[model samples]
Every structure is written in C-alpha cells, then in structure tokens.
Target chain A: MPTINVQMFEGRTLEQKRAFVKAITEAACTTLGSSPESVDVIITDVKKDNWATGGVLWTDKK
Target chain B: MPTINVQMFEGRTLEQKRAFVKAITEAACTTLGSSPESVDVIITDVKKDNWATGGVLWTDKK
Candidate 1:
C-alpha cells in the first residue's frame, strides 16, 4: 500500500478533501501503476504557529 | 533535514505529541546521525472513514 501524508494550512472544506484524495489517488495510479484500493492519503491541517519555514513560523510573519 | 511523517487515528493529547517528537527526534539523531534541529516531524490524525484496510474503511466496519 502507498500511504501519502500531506501537511497544509487548515480550513479546507469536505468537498475539497474529497476532490483532493480522488485526484491524488488517480495520479498515483497512473504514474506509478499503483492500485486505487491500495492507495491511502492522509492530510494534516497544521496551525500557522506550528509550522515554520526557513526557521520562521508562519504565525510570526508580520 | 530528515522529515518524518506519521499517520494515526486522532484524539491524542498535546503532551503525547511533545513526548513523541522528542523521542523520535532523538532516535533519528542516534540512528541516522541527523541533528535534532534538522529533523521535522509531522503527525496526521486520520478519521475512521478516511482510513481503510483490506479494501474496507474503518468507519464501515460494524
């Protein structure tokens, strides 16, 4: 099974999640020849304060 | 930097996360020789409906 974990800012609707998982699964199947039934996508909604890039937290941006 | 992503069912406390990250970072440093500051751990809390095993979603189980 191919398990994919995606970390992104929170606030996406359920409709978006449904579309996202469907698209991601299809892409993986087409590109890697993986079966749809074996693909698992886990999406994480990270807080702005919890995420940092270039050693700077997103929440700290002014 | 080594980024490790973990996928598990939701409902863990913040204290658990603090301990988890600390242990995982240490483990990576000891085994892979990666610095703690360079290691990033992202945790994904999955719902039963979003996770499946043996072609059956966990939520669908009765």
Candidate 2:
C-alpha cells in the first residue's frame, strides 16, 4: 500500500478533499501500478502561521 | 529539506507534540545528518476508522 501524506493550507471544503483523494488515487494507479483500494491519502490541514518559507512564516509573508 | 510525515492515532497533548518533534529532529540530525532547522516534522492525527491494515480498519480490529 502506498500512503500519500499531504500538508496544505487549511480551509478546503469536504468536496475538495473528496475530489483530491480520487485524483491522487487515479494518478498513483496510472504511474505506480497501484490499485485504488491500496492507495491511502492522508491530508493535514496546516495553519499559515505554522508553515515557513525562506525563514519567514506564511502568515507574515505578503 | 527533510520533511518527515507521521500518521498516528489522535488525542495527543500539545506537550507530547512538542517533545515528539524535538526528539524526531534530533534523530534526523543524528541519522540523516540533517540540520535541526532544516528538518520538518508534520504529524497527521488519524481516527481509527480512517486507518486500515491487513484489509481491516483499525476500528474493526480486535
């Protein structure tokens, strides 16, 4: 089983999550020869303040 | 950047998370030769129903 973990900014809708998992499972099946049932997509919703880029937190970035 | 993603059961305290990240960062530095600042630990708290093994969800397991 291939477990895909994603960390992204919060505020995505349930429908978006549904679409995302479906798309990712399809992509894995096409590229890695994995079955949809064998794919697991775990999504972590991260606050902007928690993520940093180039030493600056996303909340502080313009 | 070494981004370490962890999926575990939910209900962890904030202090636990702090200690866990610190320990993981130190481990990465020791084993992977990665700098503490360059190591990112992202934890995804999973519900029992959301996780499965051996074709059985944790919620259904004995």
Candidate 3:
C-alpha cells in the first residue's frame, strides 16, 4: 500500500479535497502501476503558525 | 532534511506535542546520525471518521 501524506495550509473546501484525492489516486496508479484501492491519501491542514520555511514561521512571513 | 510525519488520534496537549517532537528528534539523531537541527517532525491529528483500516472507518468500528 502506498500512502501519500499532504500537509497544506488550512482553508480548502470539501469539494477540493475530494477532487484532490481522486486526481492523486489516478496519477499514482498511472505512474507507479499501483491499484486505486491500494493508494491512501491523508491530508493535513496546517496553520500558518505551525509551519515554517527558511527558519521563519509562515505566520511571520511578509 | 529528514522529515518525520506522525498521524495519531487527536486531543493531545501542547506540552505533549513539545515532548514528542523533542524525543523524536533525539531518536532520529541517535539512530540515523542526523543533526537535530536537520530533523523536522510534523504531527497530524486524525479524526476517527477520516481514518480507516481493513476497509472500515474508525468511527464505524465497534
């Protein structure tokens, strides 16, 4: 089983999540020769304060 | 960078999270010889309805 975890900024709608998982499953199957049932996509909605880049938190970024 | 992602049931306190990340970072450094600064730990709090195993959702399990 191939489990793909995505950590993104919070605020995506339910419809977006559904479409994202569907597209990701298809792409994984096409590229890796995996079955749709064997793929798992777990989405994590991260807050700006919880994420950082270049040693600076997203919340503090300009 | 070695980014460790942990998916677990929600409801942990902020103190618990701090302890967890510290411990995990130390473990990675000890086991993988990676620097503590280079280790990133991302924790995802999962809800029962969103996670499933063996074709069964956790919320629906008895």
Candidate whose DockQ is highest: 1
* Model 1 docking category: incorrect
For residue A4, give model 3's deviation from the true position in Å. 0.6
Output DockQ, candidate 1: 0.16
Between candidates 1 and 3, name the one with more favorable DockQ: 1
lDDT of 1 by residue, A4-62 (tens): 76778887766666667778888888998998888887667779999998999999988
lDDT of 1 by residue, B1-62 (tens): 89998888888899999999999999999999998899999997887646544334455558
Q: Report residue B1 deviation for candidate 2 (angstroms).
A: 20
lDDT of each: 0.79, 0.78, 0.79
Q: TM per model?
A: 0.57, 0.56, 0.55
| lDDT score of residue A51 within candidate 1 | 91
Query: Worst lDDT window (10 residues) for model 2 chain B?
Result: B49-58
lDDT of 3 by residue, B18-59 (tens): 999999999999999999999989998887545444333455
User: Model 1 segments beyond 4 Å from truth?
Assistant: B1-6, B11-45, B48-62
lDDT of 3 by residue, A1-62 (tens): 78877788988766566667778878888998988778876767889999999999999999
lDDT of 1 at A13: 65
Sort the predicted structures by DockQ, highest score first: 1, 3, 2
